[model samples]
Target: MANLQLAVKGEYFDAMIRGEKTEEYRLCNDYWNKRLVNRKYDCLIITKGYPKRDDFSRRIDVPYNGYEIKTITHPHFGDKPVKVFAIKVKLTRSNYVAR
Candidate 1:
């Protein structure tokens, strides 16, 4: 019944609401590992750009499934393949706010 909060750009936020993005990627360095590894979260709370805490319109709440470590070559990470923790999530809940 816990939650993990994250701040992302508008495009990724929109993509999630559109059912195109299901997993949130985090770098596999010590920073992320300390927070995501062996952590159990019930919800994933994401913000469009670190808006005010009460600004639900710019935020997304999704069910957190879990996470797995993976290696991928995504531009967000850089021009080379990198290791990351792919945090699983879903936007199929009735309470999802698509704004």
Candidate 2:
């Protein structure tokens, strides 16, 4: 099991917390693809922010909630064989403030 802190948008965060969004998609990157693959269990912390392409410094530290990774999938990106992390998670807690 791995403890991973991920930043998500406010809307998506709300959806996940409300049990509307079950799966989360991550872009195909070498680091993420390697780290996420074959990981059976994950303690995912949902932060109240999203990654910006231009400014990487703009981020929130407080976690909105935590979830347990139920399943993982490697989905194709377009026509190319790309590794994407399709994480199916179950909400553990809400209003969780990360320290």
Candidate 3:
């Protein structure tokens, strides 16, 4: 049997309210062989900010108007050496709430 392992790390960035760019960070890995095999690559965390309703149909860009970001780490990957998954949150002007 082959030995394999996987892991994931996540980090949340502070809100940027005047630039117009939301940034996030994370670490992940892809496991090929192990007690369990995992073959997926996706962001374990997603973040968004809630802006007040305005005359504009769309919401201002997050970075442009300062927005908050929250990151979460999933348990798909345990603790092994794999790959790094850097996450970035881009919020466009919109009234839509995060689902």
TM-score of each: 0.89, 0.52, 0.25
Tens digits of per-residue lDDT, candidate 3, 1-99, equal 222111212222224223333543233333312212332333222322333344222232222221222344545445544343333344543622333
Global lDDT scores for all candidate models = 0.85, 0.53, 0.31
Q: Which rank order by lDDT, best down to worst?
A: 1, 2, 3
lDDT for model 3 comes to 0.31
Model 2 scores a C-alpha lDDT of 0.53
Q: Model 1 — which ten-residue stretch has the worst lDDT?
A: 90-99
- Checking candidate 1 for backbone clashes, the offending pairs are none
Q: Which of the two, 2 or 3, has more TM-score?
A: 2
Which of candidates 2 and 3 reaches a greater lDDT? Answer: 2
Tens digits of lDDT, candidate 1, 1-99 = 689998989999889888898888999999998898888888888889988877888998877778889999999888999999998767776859555
Ranking of models by TM-score: 1, 2, 3
In model 2, how large is the Cα lDDT of residue 36? 67
Instruction: Give RMSD to native, each candidate.
Output: 1.5, 7.4, 13.4
